[model samples]
Target: MKKENLPPFKITNEILTLIYEIGELIGKISVTQEFEKNLILRRENRIKTIYSSLAIEQNTLTLEQVTDVINGKRVLAPLKDIKEVQNAYEIYERLDELNDNSVKDLLLAHKIMTSELIKENGKFRSKNAGVYQGEKLIHMGSMPAHIPELINNLFLWLKNSKEHPLIKAAVFHYEFEFIHPFQDGNGRIGRLWHTLILSKWKDFFGWLPIESLVQKYQKEYYTAINNSNRDGESTEFILFMLKIINETLIELIENQKMTDKMTDKMTDKNKKRIEVILKYLSQKNYIDNKEAQNLLDVSEATAKRFLNKLVKENILEAVGEYKARKYIKK
Candidate 1:
């Protein structure tokens, strides 16, 4: 869409209220390093898990049950090669290691994460590409025959733009999705790299699960892209993403308030137990009896009971065989 025809990036009164509340919750969480760690871990894990599910759902997995596989749950669904998951994890793990705005890092991450799905993973496509809606091509766009030059221009724009971080990220996301740079896995890689760009702009954004929100509004997400294509540019998609960010922040704030209230009512011992559980969770989603004993500095029986109590109270979820059981935050 033309700039003039695009909707204003206006924050409504309701959104402003939600932002203020979210700011307060962010402040509260920032006060405790432990709380911050807990939240960030949950955010990152959920993002990776959801993206993995999305990747699997796109028919890349021949035998694997995508949903169960992504959740780390046991299932009867066929298992596909998990190299994609491994590559994505590697890129995500090294996100902070990247310090420059060069296209190399971006291309490398893309190539590695999508290697299995494309002939040119670390390199740009050599052929003309266009986005399709059903059997018909929707946009009559073509990339520079010199793929590297086109990617360089895109990165330059991304680095120099003074737009709001949210807007910039969303626009880049939609553009990348439209570009469909890779032969396959473009959608997943585009979303993933957009998040990487966003996290680089703001550390707080690294802890926000925008993908989860997008998944919840999957139809709208697709509609925003298709609608924007009917015109030109991605103004509609940008606005939609901004709304999602606002809603995600609001939900996070409400979750924090609930956690605070619940913890506030507990006794010192219970609070300590909760801290132990949260700490364990920060390292990994599931904790077993032996690890809980060491974390809580309690006997085995005591640790088991404590975990059981938490499960009974709906604070934790239990899974796996009895002898090898583990617990995760509910």
Candidate 2:
């Protein structure tokens, strides 16, 4: 393939517009320090991504089981399925270290993502391959002899293409699925790499769990792929993916707004009391409920509620237990 050769896709009006909307939603989020600091939310999103991606490939683990496995608890699912979840987590947690443009890193990712589960882990298939849904094949890959050059050409174009990352990511996803480059784990890896490509454009895509939405629209996801295959271009898939990304961004932004409204939902008096507590904490080490009652000139119960509200909003953290608890800067 020549450097000027681009992939089989078109830049339709809808793809461009969704890209713009996704960018707008992205700009609206500072989210909060909590989104970054809240390890629980991060873990949940990671688990959601792993569960949904594997579920698309017919992995037998439930969401609860995936969570348990990631949390280092024993789950009764098939050992192979459990290993797939583990492998996915391993790869996602190490996202900062992988290069989106390198075929070498792609293979390394495949290796880690399929280790102990597939006989051809880390290597491209030595025979022709196709994507399957249940017992039916939906798409066939290039012949075994063509796999290496096709992948190399794809990557070379990926590095050189001037297309938007959203478009590029979708095209790579469509092409990777079209290539079915590996003997197994193509769907999961294709989705993972699409996210890696976008995460390169925006860091938070790594944790955004677009897979959950894809899982919600699983039938449409495959239909989009099948449509692109039938049409001989990836325009259908690109439109489908850009919409998913836009929807995820809208969801994130709305959730962030709701979290912000926790403060908005406060009564005027409660809001003033919160302001007082914040001011006090700027100079003091911590604020106990007794101190809160005295400073805010309120009853013990009201003062305690205010302090707890601050804690829940992530503006302050509660330390100690029961009557001994104190509120400190988070």
Name the candidate that leads on TM-score. 2
Q: Candidate 2 lDDT, tens digit per residue, 172-243?
A: 999888888898989989999999999899777888889999999999999999999898889999999988
lDDT of candidate model 2 versus the reference: 0.85
Taking all chains together, each candidate's TM-score versus the true structure is 0.70, 0.79
Q: What lDDT score is found at residue 177 in candidate 1?
A: 68
Worst 10 residues of 1 by lDDT: 1-10
**Candidate 1 clashing pairs, residues 3+ apart or interchain:** 1-232, 63-78, 64-78, 111-121
Model 1 lDDT, residue 104, Cα = 78
Query: What local lDDT does model 1 show for residue 73?
Result: 56
Which 10 consecutive positions of candidate 2 have the poorest summed lDDT? 31-40
Taking the tens digit of each residue's C-alpha lDDT, what string does model 1 give over 47-163? 444454364345354223333344475645333345555565556657666643667776777777776666777766767777666789865434646455545656666787776
- For candidate 2, the TM-score is 0.79
Instruction: Show model 1 residue runs off by greater than 4 Å.
Output: 1-36, 39-81, 132-136, 139-141, 144-146, 265-330
TM-score of candidate 1 relative to the true fold: 0.70
